[model samples]
Each structure stands twice: as structure tokens, then as C-alpha cells.
Target: MSRVFEKRYALSRRALLRSVGGLGALTAMPLLSHEAFAQPVFRVYPFQLGVAAGDPQPDGFVIWTRLAPEPLDLGYGMPSEPVEVKWEVAADAGFRTVARSGTAVARPELGHSVHVEVAGLEPARPYWYRFTAGKERSLYGRARTTPLAGTDLQRVRFGVAGCQHYEQGYFTAYRKLAAEPDLDFVFCYGDYIYEYRGERLANGGTGPIETIRQHNEGEIYSLDDYRRRYAQYKMDADLQAAHAAAAWFTTWDDHEIDNNWVGDIDQDGTPAEVFRLRRQAAAQAYFENMPLRARSFPIGPSVQLYRRASYGRLLDLNLLDTRQYRTDQPCGDEWAATCAGVAAREAQVLGAAQEKWLLDSLSGSRARWKVLAQQIMMMDLDRAPGKAVGYNLDSWAGYAQPRDRLLRQIRDRRIENAIVITGDEHQNFAGELHLTGATPGPRPIASEFVVTSISSGGNGQDQRPDMIEIQRANPQLKFNNAQRGYMICDVTPERWESEFKVLDKVSDREGALSTRTKLAVAADDARVVSA
Candidate 1:
């Protein structure tokens, strides 16, 4: 049997402390009045957004929750005193015998959110945790720590989703995913929250119906607006439930700030300085709200979004940052003066530093599968012959020189079990990456799996004829489908399976999900096959 499925954690109480005595008790005395302490303690906001864990490592994982006095943020404008939150780990769902317990203060600066990274936990073992503040008690969340590095793990299962536009319909898809008992964790590729308003998209779309208060204060461009937007998205009961269900590894694409905007630039053509400030604000809000490590925090307009995560010897995920540093979009013929002068080789999608990191990581990885969790398609999908014209110039195809260089590295290094998982195209595609094309200089190298959006562009109902024509023109394309839903990727030592899980309908508010397609990659060949 595979160690991935058979792993277990032994429960043993390492430490325990209550507010009655100890350092936390002594610290809590001055902050709270006698009357406040006298009242019966209640875990009122036990787990406002449900218990969530993320950024897991072999030694530990981050456990999180928000302490809300009220169901919404109405009760307190801003919590003056730091709230002492308690957390525990157990071997079973019910904390019959607590293993570890600690106190963490929920600072008002972060809207009373508490994130506890419990270290020294046994690897590849399932554990349950919860948080408590006063009379309120949060729901118990289950999380599994990563297996020891290079362990011979056999199988791992996870769900990959993106572009969950709130106004389109209910989060029925997430509700369904939450109920699924098998997923180890959730990988939100991007567009977790659409920055646009309901009226902005031609319909009365409210963008995923959630309990969190909506951002009634116009389009979000500043730090405050971004914070409100995140709070609104987090309020969705289904989304909260899903978070409670498993840990999440996430990254952001353009919609998190502005659609299709490149480095330090604004989509509406705002001044460079003004746009850079906006980017900084948005980045700050993102860091504050997300369950990210301190390392991902924004430094000026840039956040280090690209990094690697491992799952024993089974898989290694290299999350890519595609939008942060890149040249502006290529202009049309009418604006040739602006586009023609731009140097294609000097232009890049991953930038120099990130690209170098990726190359180095790929060369040294020992996992059975090396997966690239990226934002856009890596395989070239040209819109016109000898001309760049598909999707947008922001994708890999737009920066041809860099794309070729990357492919050449893969070929030269002979990096085995390399796979690319992408989002942002609003369509599902399977392409056999030939590093060297017939007209090109070098030889063939990689493979790519581009997942369709959860709900974007109104379910991609209007298919582009040019896209279909282009597919026919390109022989490397194995599969293509424009749909609304996500992908469920199952990895094993022998093979990797990517199931295109699609919703029955997106136009209707209440619709079921189904597997529209399935593609598999054999361990030996690393080639995709229709299941």
C-alpha cells in the first residue's frame, strides 16, 4: 500500500494551559475589566470562517481562524484589545485526548484573525484542530502534514479550481467539493475574488453569493477597498466550509488587482506612479487576508508569490508568478510605433530572477513528479501564423524567446516527470509540448494541462472560431474544451490523472457538477492519454 494513504499520527499531550494561570493569564488580567472576565466565557465566534490550514511542511502546518464577535463585522468597528485565542491538536476528529495546546493573540490590526503554525507534528499524519475565544468555539478542522522529504509515497489527490466569479451564481460547486471526503487539500489557482461589480458584467451578477458584506463602496482600487472585498468573499458559507475542509495552496493572477495588467501598470492607463501605489495597496490587503506565510508579504509593489511545495517523493509543486514582472501587452498594427520598439528577448513573463529559480529548482528536484502550478498556458497557442494574437500578449506564447529558452533548458537538463498545470484561459486544454517545432531550432521537451475557469466569461458559451481553427493548425494539441468548472488531479508513482470536472450548467443558479473529460499521463512516457 502507498504510504500517502496509510500515514497516521500518534496523539500525545505535550503541553496544556488555560487562562486561569500562566503567562497568558497574567497578561490577560490588565487588558480585560473584572466585569468582562466575570461573565461566563463563551466561544461565540468559534470558527467564523471555519478552521483552515495551509502552507504545510514536513515539520508543521499553519492553522487559522477569524474571531468574529458578531456574524458580520458590525459589532466592532475595530477591536481595541488583543483577543487571546486557544488552539489544540488531536489524533481524531473529536479532541478526546489533546496532544498540543497553545495561546495566540488575535491582534486587531489583522481584523482579529489568528494563524498558528504548529511545529514538530509527525509527517503524513491526519490531525484535527480548533480555536476558542471566550464563549465562542470554532468548528474542528482536519489537516494532514506533509510527508518527510523524499519518502516513497505512492498516491496523492487534490482539487484545483480558479476564477470563481461571485455574481455568476451560487457557490454550489464549492459546496459540493467541501462534501467530498477524499481531497487532501485545495489548490486555488487564481481569481479567487473578482474585483468587478455585478452591474459591470452585463448582468445582475452579484459575484458568488456569500454572507460576507458586499463592497458597496464602488470599484476597489485602494487598500481599504481590497480588504473589504476579501472580507466579502470570505463570508460565503460554502467557501468558509470548503476552507474548513482542507488546507489550501494558492496564488493570484490579474483579476486580484486589474485584468490583464502587467508589472507596475494599470489597466485603465493610470499614471505609472499612481498605478504602482495601487499595486502596493492591493498586495498589502492580499497578504493581510490570506493564510500566507510572513515571507509572501508585500515589499513595495512586489510579493514573492513564486515558491515550491513538496509532497514527500510523490510530487513537487513549483507555483509560478506570471503577472508581477513582464513587458506591456503587444500593441496592434495601428500602434506599431509603441509595440515594434519593444525588445522581445529582453521582455519576459517570469522575469529573470524567478525564471532562474524555476530552472534551478527543476534541475535539482527528486520527486517522482515535478508540477508547475502556473497562471497561464505554457504551450504555444498562436492566434495567427508568424504573428502573436491569442488570448493576450501576457501568456507564454507572447514572449516567444523566453518560452523557447525555457523549453531548451528542460531538454538540456532532461528533467523527468515535468508537468505544467495552468489556469486563466477559461478553457481546458491538453497539449504535448514539443520544445523544438518543425520550423524551430531545438528539439521537443514538455507537456501542459490548462484547466478551465470555475465561472468566467459567462461559461465560455461563445466559442471563438479562430481558436478552433488554430487547434486544427497545431498538431501538438491533444485536447481542448471551453467549459465552466475545475480539475481534479490524482498523482501516483505509476501515472498522473487529470479529470476535467465540469458543472452541468453555469447559467442556472442550481446545477450539478460532472466529469466532462479525463486525461492521464503515464509515468514512463509522461504523455497525456484520454481516459
Candidate 2:
């Protein structure tokens, strides 16, 4: 049996909504001083959005929640003045022994969200937490700190999931993951919420796909719009349960702001200056909703998301921000066989500074496994069926020079057991990473595992039409599954195993999960073999 906490945190999204809807608006209550610490009365339950904790350190982590009785509204029905929120962490799920308690201000400017940075706790242990705003108490949440910097562990496990478009299907993946016991943490690699206002083509294709549900309004632009969008996603019981289950380490991809957006460049050709403002709004909402530390707080349109998380001396997890600093996609961001722009030397994915930082971190780290938790595929995938060799301009294949440079450094530095877990591209993939144009390339330097979407596509097939041909074309590709689910990774000092847990269908709430495939890599080898 997994050595997990006996108590579990569970809640239903609809029940909270139904119960809170009966309460009237906050306007029905009296005004309060901005600086007053006194509890103010809320017309509805202020903790309807649920509670979350993330960014775990050996000694501490950050806990988060928002005062949103009315989640869909632009203002969230929050009062104009700041509200004081109280937080408490306990050794037991029942709160019989409180470990730490503090107060935080949920300012109206930040959509009345509370972020409490907690410390002075034991390392590598489960802690239960909750928040209080006025008379309402939040759902109980569980968080765990990492092992000490140099401590060694026998094993580690985590889930990789993202790209959940609310309109596509249900978030049964999250619900299942929440039930998983003894997970160290969850890594949401990107596309936490799709920015599409309504049903859109499955990648600018011929026809618009039908939606199981729909967004509340048109395309989001303002801060309130982004906040409401996040609220809609957070309101899901499964997503909330997943947040409450354990601490999450999150990083974003294109859809969080706009589809295929690179820095200030919008896919629809929106002016860079105008898009910057939208990005600012998106960034702020992202900061407010996520269980992130102060290091990732948004400043205008910029947020520092690239950081390293260590789990003892066994793994060094590097969370990357690929969308925020990337150059505009090459060849108009389309699939092409032989475009000159695809190999442009100036094109960058991680940019110079971030590239240097990643390289330095990987080289300097002493951990047995160096895991790159990021968005977008780093493998050079040729999508064309036959020998045409088309590549996605939005992926690393478009920026060949930079990708080759990074791979060369990894090979030269001999960074053993390097693995990359990626989101985006609503399909599952397991492949070996090799230099693009090497003459009969040597052994792979690293490995990559791409997890499929939580619910981006409606119901996905077990196999795609061109999957076999594409695999034949690229021998480095080991496996591909077009399904809706996530990856559960089990790591040890000697090897790493990735279990591709997929859903039969995500169109409804009754989809069942099963292991589609399992792949493993040895400590010093990059070859991906069936487990």
C-alpha cells in the first residue's frame, strides 16, 4: 500500500455553487475600512473557489485561495476594500494539532486572492491546511514539503497533466489524479485553461469542433475576463480536488493567454502593444489563481516562471517558461517541408539568458536525474506522412540552431539521465532526443515524454491515421497514443518509469482510465524501452 495520509479532501463543485447562490450580493452588507482586520460579513460563501497549496520547499510552501462568492461575475462579488484572510496548517487532517497560523490580506486589486507564504515546518511531510474569510471556512487542503537539499530517497512519484479546454470535455483526468495516493506533487506543464471563447477548429482546421460546455463570454482581453475564465476552470470539482490533494508545480504554455502566442506576438496578428496589455491581464490572473510563490508573481506582462525544485539528491526538477520568452514562430507558424525560416540561426525557443540558465543548472546540479518540466515538444518530429518531412513551426524543430546547441551542450557535458516532461500537442508521445543532422547520429543524449491533454479534444482515438507512417519515418519515436489522460512517473536512483494512463473517452464524465503503455530509461542511458 502507498504510504499516504489516511484522510482525503473531497468536495463537489455544483454543491458549493448551489449552496452559495442562495446568499445575496456583498453590497447588502455595510462597508468596512481597508486596513481593518475585523472580519466582514459576506452574503455568500467566500470560499467557493476552494483552497490550494504549491511551490514546495524543504521547510515551507505557499497556500492560496480567493474570496469569490460569485465566481463568474467580473468582480467576483467581492467587496471594494481589502479583506483579511486567516490561514492555518496542521499536522493532522482533523486540525487537532496546529503547526502554523497567519493572516493575509486579499486585496481587491488582485481579485481578492490570498497568498500566504508559510514556513517553519518539518521537511518531506504531509500537512493539512484551510483558510477563513469572514464566517466561511475553505475546503481542507493537503500539501507536502520536499526532502532536504541533500537527503536521498528510495523513490519518487508525480503526475503530469495539462491542456484542459473547458469546452472540449470533462476533467475526469483531474478527478482520477486527485484519488492517486502518495504522489509527491503534480506538475501542470501548461494550457491550464484554454482562452478560446467558444468552439474553435481543432487547430485552425476545416470545421469547428462541438463543445460539451462553453465559455461564459467572448474572447478574453481584460484582467476581469481572465480572472473569470480561471474561475470557471477552478470551479470544477475535479480541478479543485486535484489542487487540494497535493502541492502543484505549474508552468504555462500558449493557451493560457492566447493560442500559439510568443511573447507579445499574438497568433491573430494583434498589435504587440495591445497584446502586451492583454498579456498583463492574463499574467495577473494566472498569478492570483495559482498556488505559486512570490518569485512567480506577475509584473506588468512579465513573470519569472523558470525555477528549479529539488527533491533531495534524487531529482532536480526544472520548471521552464517556453511561451513567455520565445521568438515568433517561423514560417508563419505553419507546417512546412522546406522553409528557410525553420533553420534560422537567430530563432530562439528559450532565449539566450534562459538557455544559459538551463544549461548552467543542468551542468551544476548533482542530482541523479535532471528533469525538465516544460511545455512544447523538444523532439524533432516530422509530421509529413511520406518522405516530405514537414515540421511544426511552433515547436523546437523550427528553431533548429538553438535546439542543436542545447543538445550539443547536454551531450558534451554528459548530463546523464536527463528527461523532459512536456505538455501542449494534445497527444501522448515517448521518444528519444537526438541531434537533428548528425551523420547517423550517436546514442540519444536525453529522453522526452509528452502527456496528452486533460480534455482538450473531445473523445480521442487510440491511434491516428498517420501515426504508423510517422513512426516509421522517425525511428527515434518509440510510442504515440491519441487519448485524453496524463502520465504518472515513478523514479528511482537506478531508473525512471513513465506509465501512460489514458482515458477511453473524455466527452462525458464516465470515462474509465487504464494503462496504455509503460516506458523506462536507465540511469545513464537515454534509450526508451518498453517496461
Candidate 3:
């Protein structure tokens, strides 16, 4: 639900291996082509990776699938030619009332993927869809369109999450989310797949720096590698179930391409030109796998992201691309006793263009709540607890002026009820947004809720040692939980309620979920409080 799309627009990492192996046989069969569009094809199911819907507009949404009879293989066992993939949307799960139907070509360049942008239908309603190629048919997908723009609504329910390192743990959080019958949509804020070849790792400190499984190949630099990595991640039943359950608005973070990568700086010290190629491959694979429109598909190294989606007059969600345009982390990308260049005026995190766009949009917003769905923490989190401020340069704290500029826009325009829902740090955080990039200062102007990972960091405790330090260091923050899970938001005209949904364990598939706590932010007060 980021980029603009018309009806025709078109449209990981781990232990993952054992889990993926259970998906089915990796055996593949012979080729099928559009010339043989009428011929029966595929010995194995072509929709092995599953179906998903995204970029939902008022009138329609984009439904997607890939023809991968042998999912793990580079070619995915599809012929090197155009394949005609047909899709249909209906009013019932049984598809009794067919609403619209069309055909799309799965090109070889795009790894034989299908993206169907469906339109000319009712808004704010449920529709079921399926894809067909030859005699093989895909599982049905369910999608819901947004309400008409400017139309007032009673409520909105959604989930926010990301950072699922397959090898690190199971996707049980996604399973729980999918089962939630009340959710309207889900915002996936990146780290969709880890780029590192599955290398088994072990705990090095307090962080989830280890993995039970490793990447099958070394550092992925080719389009095929990216596609395969994505395929591997997609094999998870829980993840696929969530995709089928509700519409998703997704954006990328560091691991989707490379860890903590900024612009051409891949953090791995790859040259800008070399990293550009990798980025290009990663971007292309991302587009092919995602339920995005042709409007957002990549052209070489760049893809159009950072767009707005409105849920009637109740909410305006702005999905942002922070890693694509940001400058390298100031004073090196690490937590230090002090980072010197953090306050430089010219340093950009959102870049001048996106900054202007965000500021202008926030200033002009007429909705009750403006939520920024993005990667990385926007709140200034102190790495070292003390009176002398120490900051993590990898976040908004590194690009000081730009953050201040946006905060100033809010403070100046009185952009009431603007909140940021973020993902990255594998821990949940609820805080009041203050202009001071460093927290525990000034009056609250906006609010931020950083959702924990789906799995990435492995199973954690009810509390971590740093929680007390962080809370004491930054009073603006109201909550912190180092667990494996996500957050649920139930928004209404008067109050926005949040529940920190946590999982007792994510080391395997046998975990159960419970709410750690619930928070509420009154519409006008813009302060996080106990619900």
C-alpha cells in the first residue's frame, strides 16, 4: 500500500532449510510455454511458494504468485519463454460470483512470476483470487481494498512486524497474526530475507547473532541467488498463511539487500559500483517476488517506493524507504561513547526529496492519525546509559538535522496525532516523540512504536538487562520488551490502542502467544499510556 497503482498496474534466510524441505519434493519437470498455454504442464504444483495480495487501492488490489514447480532451483523449473498466467477475482471463497478475470505474461527476465493488478471492483470489501497456467492452478488468495479516500470510518485494526531470520527461529508470530480475525491489514517493515549464505551461528553475546541453519550459497550477488533465497524463505507455512490471511503493505530494510547498507555503501565494504549491481539484483528479485505493480518495479538500480495509502478519513499511512537514500552512518556505523558528525546539517537520512515529501504530507494531512510505516527506530535511543548522551548512529540519531526538520514540521504545523510504527531492533519499544533526537527531553509532539521481530533475534526473556537502563536513560520511552513477536493496533476516532503481542519461544514451531502489555495514546494528547 505504498506506491500508486491503477487497475492495470500489474502487479528467509534459514533453519528454514529443514522447514522448507518439509514443504514438498524439490524435484522438477520439463518445460511449458505460452505456445503450449492450453497444454497441461507441471508434474509438481506451480504455486509451491504460495499466493499473496498487496498494494490495495480503493477499487482494487494486486494479487501475485510464481510458477515454481521446483522451488529451490535457479530457473524454478520453468521454461525460458513467456508463460500465460491467468487470474480471477470473485466474491466468495468458492469463487461463486466471479467479478473480474485477466491474463498476465510471466516473463523469463522476471523469473516466471505473475502480478495481477485487479480493479473496477467494490472498495473496502473482500475478494478471492487464483492464478492459472496451463492445467495447473494456484491456491486461492484473499484480498481487501481500501475504503474510498476522504470517507470517514469507525475503526481500523492492523499489525506491524518484520525481521524474520528463518534459521534463527520459526514464523509462529505470523501464524498468530494470520489467525487474528479482526486485523484489516499488516505492515511488514523489512528484513524479509537475510542475504548472508546460511552459515550456522551461535550466540556471541545477548544478541541473536547465531543461526541453526545457514544460507545454501555464499553471499548472494546474482538475481538467481536472490530469487532462490526468497523462495527458501517463502516455504514457511506460517509466513504463507499470514500472506493468505490479509493484505500486506511491505518495505525493505538492510538484510533484504545487505546488512546496514546505505546507498552504495554495503557495510561489507563492497565498492559502490559493485554493490550497485548487487542492489540491482536484489531490487529486481524483490519486485518479482512481491505483489507490487509495474509502477513500482525496478528500472536498473532504482525502484519507486515511499508512497501513501489512505484508509478512509480515519488514517493515512506513509510507507517510507530509509535505506535507499540515506547517507552512511555518521562517525562510522556503530554505537560509540560519542558520535561526532551526527549533528551535521547536510547529513541526510530521508534525503532532501523524501524529507520534503514527508514534511509536506504531514503538514497537509487532514486525517485523524498519520502513521509512518518504516524501517529502523526513529526515536533517539541511547546505546550507553549515562548523563553524557551516547547514540546509535545507524538510526535517525545519525542524521540529526533532517529528523529535527521533520519534527519541527510537526511541532510547527501542530501535525496532531502523527505516529511512527517501525521495525529493525528485534525488541519492542513504545515512546513519545520529542524534537530532541536524544530522548528524555522536551514536550511530546508525536509518538513512535517500534515492533519487535517476527523471529530474527531468537527467543528472548520477559525483560532484558538493558531495559532498566534504557527506560531510565530515556523517560520518553514507555515500554521495552526483548521478545520474539509483533504489535497489534486497534485505532478509533478517540484513542489508538496497542498490544505488545509476544511469543514465549521462537526457537522452534511450538510456541504460544500472549500480550505482554497494552498501550493507548489519546488522539489529542499524543502520549503513550496504559490502555
Candidate 4:
């Protein structure tokens, strides 16, 4: 569907759907055969993969469900043809007041997945949704629209979480996230699934970690492989519950395709041409599973995942694609001292176009808070604990010049309340941001809150000796924790409060969650402090 038609349809849908209730079943599109209108019979429940909603706008949000009668089977245990799936939106949980009802075709080309860009919803309100295929019914889901553009919001709450390796541990953190009652949305930072077959050495440095479970037979590369991998992850009940509980704002990092992949360059040095094919498959599989809008559909190896979402005059969320447009990681992409490559003027993390877009958006945004919901830590952290200085070349520290330029621009442009939420570190960090080359003396221009992994690092400790040494070395860091958990942020007009919710263990299914730390940044100040 073209954008022009979509807008027109959305404008008219509000009135059309008002009279649609109890008006009998709508006919299927004429392009299909008579059998398209017939009810399907399923041996297994088709909605085993569950339901989800994401990328909410003021008027509506996207609702998604894949028809997988047997998710583990090849082809998702569905016919190699299109199937009509029924969907409904209601104002109440019991679906007493139907808001919209329609039929969507689940096409085989997209692995029988359904992505319906629901429109005509009331702004800043909650809506209940569900799906039906034949005699099977999907689990009910709740989605909400943001406030109208420029609407003054007093407060908003959300969660930041990512990095769930299926083999490492159970998705207990996700279950905790799903139970958050007042979240407006969940910003999923990345590493939704690990590409490796099973538990491997942490960053290929630490010794091989034990696994509570196991991934499929091999590392995924082909389209079928990627699809099956996503199916396996989505089959988790905890993950499914999180998706159903709230709308999601998602973007992928390195593990979505390959570990430490740089643009078209694969980590193992696969040729760009060959790796592009792998990236194509990975991108398609990502879109098929994500509740993204039509505009984010993959074209070859590229998808426009860098976009902006505004929540009235309160927040401007710029979800960035750091992995897709980045130059190769400098200094061999490992923990090392800053090298000449790190200072190269040509090095890019957001690329030329994306960086310009981000700067321009930040400059023009009228929102009270400007958020960069992205992958990778932006703060230049010294990873080494002692006399020898080291940094992760895959992070912003790898491109020191670029990092300095971005921070300098933030300072020069006077972008107030600039906050960054990052993923992929598997360890929580609350840090103050400064120019990499600056002679820093507590003059931070921004703040960053890095959420830990969902279950990637197994059962992590509350604190480690090495981490203590590192934290002592970097005084700019306000707090750090090595645990499996996520972060919850509560934003108001005056202050932004962040709470680190940590789990004792993810290797086991039952562990209590606790708040490890709580920090806040005043609207006029960039430093993070105890709340």
C-alpha cells in the first residue's frame, strides 16, 4: 500500500468503522479465490507464537501475529498459500465495544505473518486487540497511542531492555517487564536473539559459559534459518507476554545479523557481496517478525530503521540504526588503547546522512526531552582497570572524533535534557556524557542509562572485583551493576527518574526481582544523581 492511500484510508476509517459493528462479516478481497473466504481447520493452535503491537502513533499502532500452527516445523506448518486472518480492536478488555474489525491476508511470501497498521484510534488511550485464524484465537494484547503532537504531557513511563540469548538462560526478566503496569512502551535496544548456536565465550575472551538450554543445530544464515530462529525465540511465553503487555519501540544491533558485523562486512571477513545476501535474509526475517510499519519493509539488504517518534511536546524519540551504516570497528574491534584508527576523520557510527538527520532533528525538536534510543554505549568508557587505558572499539569510543563532534554539537545546539538509552553491554551503567577529548571536570552535556541484558550473561553477580576496579578508574560513571535485568524510566516535566530493576538469577526460572539502584536527571542538569 502506498503512503498516500494509507493516509486517506486512515482518515476515512474512523467514520467507516464507527458503523461497522454488528454489520455482518466483511467480504474478502476479490483478488483471491472463493476458498479464501472459507474457514481454515488447524491441527495445532495457529497463534502459538502469540500477538504483539508496536511503533505507536497518536492515532494508531501496528498489530502483528504470525500464523504458525506448529512453530517448530518447517514452513511454520502452514500451506504455501495465503490465509485470511480475522482481527479486532476494542475499547474494553472483554471486547464489549468493538472499535475496528477486519480481515488480513497472511501471505506465504512473508512466512504467513500478519502486520496490520491499525489506524483511527483515539490518541493517548488504551485499546485491546486479538486475532483469530479458523477456530483458534490468539492471546489478548494491549496497545496504546501516544498523545497528540505538541500535547503537553505531565509524565510518561517506559522500560528499556534487550539482549536475550535463548541458550544462556530463561527469560525471567521479560516476565518481570511484562508485569510493569504503567509503561507507555518498551524500548527494545537490540540482540533480541543471539546468532550463535549455543553458549560461547563471553566476547570470545572469557571462557565458554555453561548453558541452561540450547539453540537450534547451527548458526543461522539462510532465510529459513533466521525465520526458524525467530520462531523459537518468540515461542517463549515470557517474551510473548512482554510483547502483548505494551507497545514496543524496537531497533536491532549487531547480534541481530552477526556478532560485531560492520555495515556489509561480516565478523569472519565474509566478502561484502556474500554477506549482503546473508544481511538480506536477516533483514527480511527481522521485518517479518517485528511489528514495524510498512515503510520499514526490507528492500534487499537495507531497511530504513532510523526514524523519529514524537510524544507530544514531552519527548522526541530518535531510534537509530547504528549497525547498518557504521564503518568498520577500529583497533581490531576489541578492548584496547586508543589507536590512530580511532582518531580518523572518516570513521562514522551513524554515517554521514544519519548523523546529519539526528543533528537536524535534535536542533528543531520542541519536545522537553530529546532521546536517542539506540544500540551501543555512547560514553567513552575506559575498560581497563589500571595504568593501561582500554576501550571497546565497537562502541562510540572506537570513533573518538565522531563522538566528540556529536557531543559538541549537543552542547553547541543547546539540546536540553539530552538522554541516551543503550543496549548490548549486558551490564547496567549510569554515566555522564562529555566530549572525548575534553579536559573534563564535571561539566557533562548529557546523560546515558545503559540497561543490562534480559538473559544473555546467565546469572550475573551484584558486583565483581574487576568491575569495581573499572568503576573506580572512571569517575564519570555514577553507577554500574553486573546483573540480568532491565531499566524503567519515569519522565516528567521537571525530572527524569531511572530505576534499575535487577534479577538475582536468570539461569533458573524463578528468581525475585529487586531494584538495585534509582537515579534521576533534572530537566536543567545533565548529570545523573541519586533520586
Each model's RMSD to truth, in Å? 8.6, 8.2, 8.2, 6.6
Q: Distance (Å) between predicted and true CA of 424, model 3?
A: 0.3
Question: Worst 10-residue stretch by lDDT in candidate 2?
Answer: 1-10
Candidate 1 lDDT by residue in tens digits, 1-531: 211111123211111122223322211122322222111143243354566777778767778776553433432232344456778888788899676777666654555566666777888887888877655577787777888987998888988878877665556667767777678778888888778753433533655433222334467787767766776677777777777777788899988888887887767788989998988888876766666665675778888889999998889999899888777766531221224423366768888999999999999899888888989777765556335434345577666677778888887898988889999888888877765344322233667888877667555543466668777867677788776777888888988899987776666657677877789888747566786
Highest TM-score, which number? 4
lDDT of candidate 4?
0.85
lDDT scores in order: 0.70, 0.84, 0.81, 0.85
lDDT tens digits by residue: candidate 4, 244-346: 9999999999888999997899889898999999999999899889988877888899988999989889899999999988999877776757678988998
Q: In model 2, which regions exceed 4 Å deviation?
A: 1-35, 200-210, 439-442
- Model 4 residue 407 lDDT score: 91
TM-score of each candidate? 0.84, 0.91, 0.91, 0.92
Ranking by lDDT: 4, 2, 3, 1
Per-residue C-alpha lDDT of model 3 across residues 371-396, encoded as one tens digit per residue: 88898787876777766677767788
lDDT preference between candidates 2 and 3, better one: 2
Where model 1 places Cα greater than 4 Å from the true spot, the runs are 1-47, 68-77, 200-215, 332-343, 384-391, 435-444, 460-466, 507-509
Q: Tell me the tens digit of each residue's lDDT in model 2 across 1-531.
A: 111111122222222121112321111122233323445666677787899988999988988898888888757876555665678899999999999986666767678787777889999999999988767789899999999999988889999999998988899999999999899999999899888776443442456555688898888888888899999999999999999999999999988899899988998898999999999999989988888777677788999999999998899999998988888888788775648877888888898889999999999999999999999888888888566768877888888988899999999998888999998889999999988855335478899999999998767888787887887778888999899999999999999999999999888899999999999998898899998
